[model samples]
Target: MAEILTLTALGDNYIYLIVGAGDAVVVDPGDAGPVLLALKGNGLRLVAALVTHHHGDHTAGLAQLKAATGCRIYGPDSRCISPLDHLVRDGDLIDLPVGFVRVIATPGHTRTSVCYFLPQTEGGPPSQPAANARCTRPCPADVRPTTGPALFTGDTLFTAGCGRLFECDAAAMHRSLAKIAALPDETLIYPGHDYAVEDYMFTLSIDPHNQAAQQALRHLRDAQAQGRPIVPTPLAMEKRTNLFLRTDDPPLAAALGIRTDDPATVLAAVRRRKDAFQPS
Candidate 1:
């Protein structure tokens, strides 16, 4: 099993290191300083780096890290970004020392945004390519596992919120979120930023009656007070607390005073509300 480490950079951004067999793969490295220090401290070799989007905070460290380690850089097919050794697309898999990192296209935060899904292997390869797995409308039943699948959602999905629709419309973001919701309930969510407290607060603003969100907020507060990192949230916990993932929930729609049952429409309304929201 690969060991995952979270490094904070640029104040709020998170850089993840997946270490196994003395080899490490970093995801969305915003700063090379912290990553390099971590690699040296752990005495691990940098094999590859995965990018989820072309944002500066995510890719700024790519060129430097690659220059230092000579590691392969994998990311979306976009011209805005540079130093990409491999340009991947939806359903594409990049083999790493830890395991296979399946690329799932999630364009909303940006036109080229993507998420990386790493499924756990018990001493062997997966039963089949995860790209071949069929996904249904709301959720997928085929991807569920007991434990050890991690989704690197960079600016796409947060603890209780989703990314702003920078280059795409609300419909596009909603579709991308639906794909993430299809992952296994036990799948751990390693988002690009540390926005748990603010996000959960926003979730409560939209879903005031959600006891799960209330409880989660309290837990997050306690974790923060204890100086613990609040991340790698389980998909099951997000399903219960994240408003973006609960667009189809009738109560949430009612709370928003939206009459439509269409998730996309509901999501648009919620996103607008969130855009205008001011935290107290």
Candidate 2:
């Protein structure tokens, strides 16, 4: 499997480096400085860049990086950005040094928003015995395995929150989120920003009794205190703790005092509450 490196940029934005065979593909490079430094430090060549949207924060560094490395830029079909070499659509696959990345159209954060999914493949023989073996044991709760499929959601999904509705309505965002929710439980979600603390706090306000959210908030606080990255959240964990993903749950709707059972309505209500919520 290709190695994934998370680089912090523009404060909360996350720039990912998908590296393999001495080549790297950058995802959402908000700033070119860190990416360029990383490439030189690691002696890696920039092969390509993947853009999820046309937001300046996500695409500002594209021109600079391309000028430096002459890399190909792949993104949603848009005329605004000038460096785009390939226009990707839903279900389109792009070959990379790591493997093939499948594009998932998620249009809510932006009309051109799209996510890249990298399916996990077995990397040779397992270093340890199978589950049936006598010496097999479960991994610790704090230790999450990184060798799994990954979803690069640029601003569309956060650790415990979804992006604000900018160019799309709540219903459109709901549909976009549903597509992401349908991925495998083990798919690792790499979102664009670091909003764990505020997002989880908001979640607690809505579902105060949610033990999962409570535990997650504590974990996030600890991770933040230690200057750790609270990301690459698993899809299974999000389904359990993310209020946005749980809009369809009856209990979540009741928490919002919403009488309707329609998920989109509940999501709209919850989203409104979140927008006005002041995190304590």
Best by TM-score: 2
My TM-score estimates for the predictions, one after another, are 0.90, 0.91
Q: Alpha-carbon error at 23 in model 2, in Å?
A: 0.9
Clashes of each: 0, 0
Off by over 4 Å in 1: 121-147
Cα lDDT of model 1 by residue, 185-221, tens digit: 7788989998888888888887788898999899889
Judge candidate 1 against the unseen true structure and give its global Cα lDDT, from 0 to 1.
0.83
The 10-residue segment of model 1 with minimum total lDDT is: 137-146
lDDT of each: 0.83, 0.83
RMSD of each: 8.6, 6.1
